[model samples]
Target chain A: MPYTAEISRTNPGCFIFLVDQSASMSDPIGSGEMVQQRAQVVSDAINRLLTELSVKCAKEEGVRDYFHVAVIGYGHTQVGSAFTGGLAGRDLVPLSEIANNPARLESRTKKVPDGAGGLVETTVQFPVWMDPVTNGGTPMTRALGYADSLVARWVDEHPGGFPPIVLNLTDGESTDGDPTSAAIGLASHATADGAVLLFNLHVSGASGTPVTFPDGEGDLPDTYSRLLFHMSSVLPSHMRSYAASQGHRVSDATRGFVYNADITSIIEFLDIGTRATELR
Target chain B: MGAHSTHLDVQWFLVPKTGSSSEECEDAIDVLLSPETSSLFAAVSDGASESLLAGAWARQLVHGAVALMSAADEESVVGQDGLSRFVVEDLLARTVDQWDGYLAKYEAERIARGRPITWYEQPGLDKGAFATLMAVHMREAPADPENPKAVRRWIWRAFALGDSCLFHLRDGRLLTSFPITDGHGFGITPQLLGSRNRNASLIADRVSTATGELRTEDELLLATDALAAWLLSHPEVDSGGAGRQLGRLADLDQELFAEWVQNERDKSRMRNDDVALVRMRVKTEG
Candidate 1:
């Protein structure tokens, strides 16, 4: 027989979350919630996402064989050990460990209706991966660069594997330098046979239209949206399904933010990223 | 009122071009070794290279089917009859079920990993993971207390669902050759494939020609796609070659078998197809 190779068993894919924790993130939106408060909502969403993932992985042999998750945050130039305050420097960590830590700063709690006339209460954790320090300028460029390197390293280890996904949540423009170059650099990484996909969640306080891909002159800065769009990889099959099922609901195209007063938008963003990254 | 005991050698090869391997074969064999039937039934599944995961699908078919067969009552003639059909029907159903379950879990895992879930889209049924199956049930009949050659044997049957086959040669005379399935021609385009058309039932053939007398010179060759291509390349081979070359190649050198396959593949007679062959020689009369 000619050389026959073992095909890889079908695997789901991996997802990494990159959150922004700059001091400017503390700025309050137009009579709504501040960036600091929104961080808790996103964290709650991450916790919910983890719960859903664990349930799904337990039932699937291939899913367990193929999937992994990590979270990274950027702010005050510190990385790693979200709850412990020990800086590991621009790295991602699993969710369960973060949930167990007591030293992590707590974001505000909110109780929103579950659509059944019942209120569901939740606590938001600050900086799941990297925390923000108020001392310096916004390093959106460096953050993008770090995220790019992270995804590249992930794909190199998983050849013939599903591509990795990066979901970067940001509030402001790059103050340290131009972010366009870093965005392009991030777009260049891919597996031997596949590619990495990145999504940008631009959180703004102004009333505007939500530009997911960003062209010229919409709600948020079109240039930033375009840059992020350029850095993003094509939507995979799974990611498309997820987006179709939940993206619209979470990230209202009409609203310029990923979430509203409640903190549910973070879950929606995750839904979009999760579903979009599943493309084969 | 009752019967017991079972023994048989089962073998298979993965279609090379299709990217199936002997490792998968070994996995199928492990499943086949279960204590499910008194007359062990062996199978080989060849994946269609034109489809993705066909090889893995083929291996899954054999292993899953064998696991199903082990639970069948080997001594009950009527029960075996129903089981023969159930093995195919139930096995296919189980495989599909397993696949769906895997997909669901895979999707969830993606979410947990903070990734999305994507399902592969094939134009038609044959485009997704699909494989051909060939299987046989063999049992050694009770021996005449003092004479081993007098031992009666029963070949419950050799069954197929889709293209794989089982063949037997009695003193160089071709007795049987099962043919591959010609599933819906929708495979011609990328837009035609769907889950409904992946596998098709080819033919069900049981050979009982050599039951009465046993000869050590008899030979049986069970094969999937690739090996079939080689046998077809010989001077006088065709769709009927499985039944034609049975006993004729018994005494032929094993090297010739390998060479025939190689030459045919090189000549494109086999088209670099995945080939899996199982050659068996009756060592003793019983």
Candidate 2:
């Protein structure tokens, strides 16, 4: 089985990463000054997913030949740059060049643990695609609608095969509109062999309890989380291997959401998700 | 002639990625010809390009069909209407039933491994592997001296699931031909001859158009897609003449014909498929 069911290294599916750039995510997590900032952690995690996906493309034939991928970041009620293209608010660009292009360094910093029991701050340039932007309210509902169009077109072309996966990393409710219907529609579009999988990475509040939605409660105003979770693709085996290598163990049963302030869970999730999609 | 006498010549053309392997080709051809009373039967099955293991499927059909029919002890038919028609139908049914079982076991194995089943999601038909089949049975003619040129009669009943060809040539002219089943272009291309939803029975019924007498000085040539294209392009060369050439093949260098085919003939006109040719000379009139 592939990593993200639909997105492969070859004709890798399009992944629209809807990051929560609403000023709140910048806060430190759990009163731990020692831990890296949440924004930095999220960016690091996205970078890790991109690296894992790129490596998979080089090693796996099916992933290299069949999978085509694109990453779109939605934040502050508007679309941001694609992970590979760096274009501001462009439509999804299929990932043909990203896998073949030479690796270049993008400026990003993270705290590395000093081997001698203490934590030493280290700044390293990483391969970056989309920079985090914080501007307005979370338009998660609108993002889901946009995802529906993108995914639906892909499914129309590959109806008898696995539908592409859409993984959304968000921490709050949508301010634009109800995203439940769009998410539901996305989940229903699958191939004859397998269906589309949508998963959400919920980064909880820093100081307070994390806000989670779609907890089987009809009272929730939006079903954004519910639909995203439902549309998440199956976690492939090799991705689990990558996650295990990254010191995060995940099983096949693990769905889209892995919530915590550490943001490491999101990194692991994307790593696994990207790797699974690369499988033949 | 004794009923036990076998007369048909079978050549299995492994079309690049299609058809049975050389090792299994004999066994598969034997299976399609298992009727003891009428020992002569020839078949050429072209593997589906879309399938991952099209060659294996073709081999399985031939071997399984012959074994099943032989065990059943089906009555032997007479003439073109009898032999070709009956054998094609019988082989098709037997092959299909066995194929269903094969698929069932395959699915079971997938379930055991806890892997998502995608065995049937072969690449698109245009780019994928698939097979076509053509089988023929010949009977000995009666011993009659009235007509010196009296030739044996042949029942050339054929079934085509894919693009392979079954040709009958008499006096250097085309006697009759079977239609190739052109399937839906995209998605799962329809199985023209082999088992995949549409089996030999349905395809034989749909594609079979010619059924009649085959006279001596006549030749029946059955081929896979590539060789069929090659044979069709070279209209000037008589296969009957080629059949005669086989007798003198050992005296000449083996490279001569291949060199002629590649260097002398128009390169694009040749079929890239594995070629299987069967030629029988009629000795008596039926």
Number of the top TM-score candidate = 1
- What DockQ does each prediction reach against the true complex? 0.02, 0.03
TM, every model? 0.46, 0.41
Worst window of 10 by summed lDDT in candidate 2 chain A: A56-65
Q: State each model's CA lDDT, in order.
A: 0.48, 0.51
Return the lDDT, model 2, position A256. 50
Find the candidate with the highest lDDT and give its number: 2
What clash count does candidate 2 reach?
Answer: 42
Per-residue C-alpha lDDT of model 1 across residues B1-286, encoded as one tens digit per residue: 3443324433333334322233433112222443533355566766543344444566666666555555553542124333343444565565655665654564577689985432111122223455566655455455777886553564434555444555565654445555432222112111211123424232112211112222444455667644554454345443345435533443355456545555765565564444566655434322
lDDT of 2 by residue, A1-280 (tens): 3223333322345555656676666666545554655665676677666555554343211113345555555566565444544433455554434543423465656777899888888765456655555556777777777777777888778665555767777666667776767777777777664566676776756543332222332322336444545545445455555656766545655455554434545555666555442232
lDDT of 1: 0.48
